[model samples]
Target: MSVIREGKVKRVLEDPESSQHVIIEFTNFVTAGDGAKKEELEGKGRLACDITEFLLQYLSDKGIETHYVETLEGPKIRCFRAAILPVEVVCRNVAAGSFCRRYGIDRGIELSEPLVEFFLKDDKLGDPLITEEAVMRLQLVNRSDIGFMKSIALSVNHYLSELFAQQNLRLVDFKLEFGRTADGRLVVADEISGDTMRIWNKEGESLDKDLFREDSGDLLSAYVGLLDILRKTDPKIIPIRSEEVHVMVMPKEGIKNPPGEVTRKGLIRLGFQDVKEVRVGKEFKIVLTRPLTSSLLKGLELMNIKLLTNPIAETHEVRLS
Candidate 1:
């Protein structure tokens, strides 16, 4: 595979046989604070691919234009050739992340409606915000392109916010990147995972990539939790089923204010200032009532999204023994 661009979490490679297509390979590599923090977390690639595939397909079904073709096995996907624009369209529904820090707004403050902003996608400059006029002035894209991007960004926030609300998650904010086709058509490109969006549960608890960015929980487990919630909305996400599958769900590390947290407070007051952090998660053993097979195992894995765990907040394992 000829390399096109290697990004923080994915690698883009030129498709050897097709001049008009490319292959995107997701990596388990995780980075935050713009490369200040990084890790090679196992299962990260598969989680990103699954979420991206589901969301891209969701947008396609909603009559939105996109470059998504289909997800292949593992962490790779195929797409039509297009040049990515060096701009990120951000949609915000709640006060959080850079929005709060930049404007000095309180975190979790709800916005009356969706808000759209533009940022130049330059890591060296820390992705500084740019005005629509700046975009046109720089000749990166014209005013028409900016309007189109904002329109679609808000549209996406509407669809996704409602979609997540059904699963009791609040869509706080998200980032989107677009690409222009050879024929001048702009379409949604790149992946949308927990890495790009900020999500909160119905109870106002952070559950998206913010967990990792804030050092409050395990990112891998949170990614798994999100995948679980999303898979419930799409039955076609996976098609494996048998009654004889066993699964185990557990909380990822770095969790804050777990059930164990309640116990630690009393200890601290008792002069045990040495008390450290307490993390807690759950474990469930699933037993099926049919013969075991690879297909069934896959089905059980898909079912995990429904209840076994939340891909946004937990990590799980599957085994027969």
Candidate 2:
């Protein structure tokens, strides 16, 4: 077994049967603070592997070059061989963690724009921050390579952000690593999942590797939750009905959460007395292919009940618009 690199969370094994392929195995171990903190959680490996596998395929289908080939037995994957880079690309959307402590910025203060940073992937050096110019000057990666990595990093950021947002999760930040194939073709390497991302749900619940780092509750469960949400809500899932019809589910009567008196008064004070009340409700628009058969209509009704609206308080109407 040509096991080249074994990290705390994953290991790379060269496949004896395939020269151009390697087996990346996810381990149960979770590490943080440059490996200062560590623990082995049962089922962590499988959850991480599941999410990484889905995301690799997701990004690949979106035209991002990745080393992932296919999922193997259990928590393992067959991936293309690449000369791994020693730099970690960090992308941030909302301020948190080290960024807040180092820059004295308040937590959750959204950046005017997403910030991209580079760091050396050295535990001994504590993954010290590195400048793009330094990356080229030190001959680690040339300017062109740096630019390519940045572009890929930003692209992944965009896609992943949308991916999580679909499930009502905010991707605060993530770490990505890139590598070069034997022919020097740049491709995204390593795994992505809760371990590499800072995720927050619609209700602002922390649901990623931060649980382990911050001593939060049920680290493994959080990892599983992340994978579960992604798998259930991923557009790749079959029940998507994407190629067929457009089902718009709107409530027959809006929810009774109208604007407060102050809001109404403020609107009136602004010379908008014409607007007396504002009741807000949700409308779900799902696009699927045509030919909405009886069976499909039943499924849509089931969906409308299960995921769209509350039958007791709100009723929904599904229309092919």
Candidate 3:
């Protein structure tokens, strides 16, 4: 097979049997922080290939066009040849990781609505988020193509979110890439596995690349576990509806509130001397696929006390909807 191209974690080769197809080989190579950190884990490539195959097949069965044709030998797959786009599409269901850092919001805050974003696929520039206008101006993709990608990305997010929720895992966020075939058809290309997505268990533990990025857990073992989950997950399973749990954090009555007092003074100084008081509080909304049982509420309350508030000076209220 003649080589078509090579990337950090995978290589593409021309398929001798069909000129319209290519063979993609996943490598053990992994990187994080824009390739500032790197490592090779044994069996990681095969695990990635299997995970991608499972997900892409699920998507294709859902009537989404993808480059995936069939799984070949270990760590390899045959796919239709397409000119991969130079844009990365990201869909976020919750506030976490770079989303929190970028927006200065606390992690774990469930979004009121899912968000889709675009980034230039240039590693040299840290793949900074790009606007649709910028994408058009840069000629990276046309306006219509942007709309198509955004729509498909959201659809993928919806399906993947339901799939993971069934397995009791939260699909926090993921990145996707699309390409155009010789017939000018837009199809999802590249891999979708632990490396391309962020998944968290019910306890908010990372099951994706964050373990490798943060150096806090075993990457290979996590990937293996993810593969097992995907292998058993039924793409045709009915989706479980998620319930919204809202948590409100506020200062305890009679507690000294220096920040609140400052805000009150500022509001009064601006004009209204009748400004009586000001209180600052935080609100968090968490979505759960499981029933809101007493035990679950206890766990959430414990989490609030341990991580969401100062027990001595703050109180929290939990409500379900």
Candidate 4:
């Protein structure tokens, strides 16, 4: 593995097996106070990794593509290669924290529209939140990109708000990042950990940032307790695919128009053995003799299926006879 870059909590490395990307090793140190102060909080890194993985999986299921791939080791997360944007996208639906301190807004007051803010990723300057004009003046990103990012960030916050509400928690605010892949597609990047979010309990008690601010001296313990509650309340399991495999041939365009036998033959020529005729918009099932491989995944990508949705499987199981 070749070292690409090292940050406070993660290190990027070039994987020799694939030229297309690198992996990120998540670290154990937690930093606050604009990176001026650092503390080795026990289990902080693992907690972050777990929370991030959960959020990434949830978002991906809702048609959002994130940089997360999988966990490599105990607390390390592997991610695809990308050029990271140097701005933190903050989306808030309610007034809290800096929003209240800076603008004299009442905490917990809902806004008519979601507020999207951008902050430069400079720790020395205390990561001051700035306006889009300031971002353009500094040449951080183009105007069009900023507009697109704001739209996407608002969409993300809406999605997350609904999701957490399902879990009986209020998502006060959160930060997001974006990265451009090698193919020039911009996707949501970075970890969505507890540190980057403000989670509130049913009683409107702070479950996240209050640990750091209240001087309670048991921040890590409080975080772990919250994790335990989450695990017990909303455990997730990946469903096992049935022994019978289902394969469907979806046309690139209209489903109402039926393809001729020659088109079916072409599908057979394209390595789709046992192609069967079926009614439009109906599913067909086929049993597979082997599990899917990386090559097959690449073929699916070439067919544009990967770009249409997240390609990473939530869980993979193999069968051999």
Best by lDDT: 3
- lDDT for each residue of candidate 2 in 105-219, tens digit (9 for 90 to 100): 8878889888889999888888888998888788898755675567567767777887787888999999999877775567888999889889997676689888888887788
TM-score each candidate: 0.72, 0.72, 0.73, 0.67
lDDT per residue for candidate 3 within 51-99, as digits (tens), equals 9999999887766688999999867999988998899999999998889
- The predicted structure with the larger TM-score, 2 or 3, is 3
The lowest-lDDT stretch of 10 consecutive residues in candidate 4 is 312-321
- Which runs in model 3 stand beyond 4 Å of their true positions? 238-321
Look at candidate 4 and tell me the lDDT of residue 174. Answer: 89
Q: For candidate 1, write residues 216-277 as lDDT tens digits.
A: 88888888888889877643332222222235665667555457787788788888998896
Model 4, which residues run further than 4 Å from truth?
228-321
Q: What is the C-alpha RMSD, rounded to one decimal, of candidate 2?
A: 16.5
- Segments in model 1 whose C-alpha atoms lie over 4 Å from true places: 234-321
What alpha-carbon RMSD in Å does predicted model 3 have with respect to the real structure?
Answer: 15.6
Report how far residue 220 has shifted in candidate 3, in Å: 0.7
Candidate 3 has its poorest 10 consecutive residues by lDDT at 289-298
* Pairs in clash, predicted candidate 4: none
**What's model 1's overall lDDT?**
0.78
Model 2 per-residue lDDT at 312: 75
Q: Which candidate tops TM-score?
A: 3
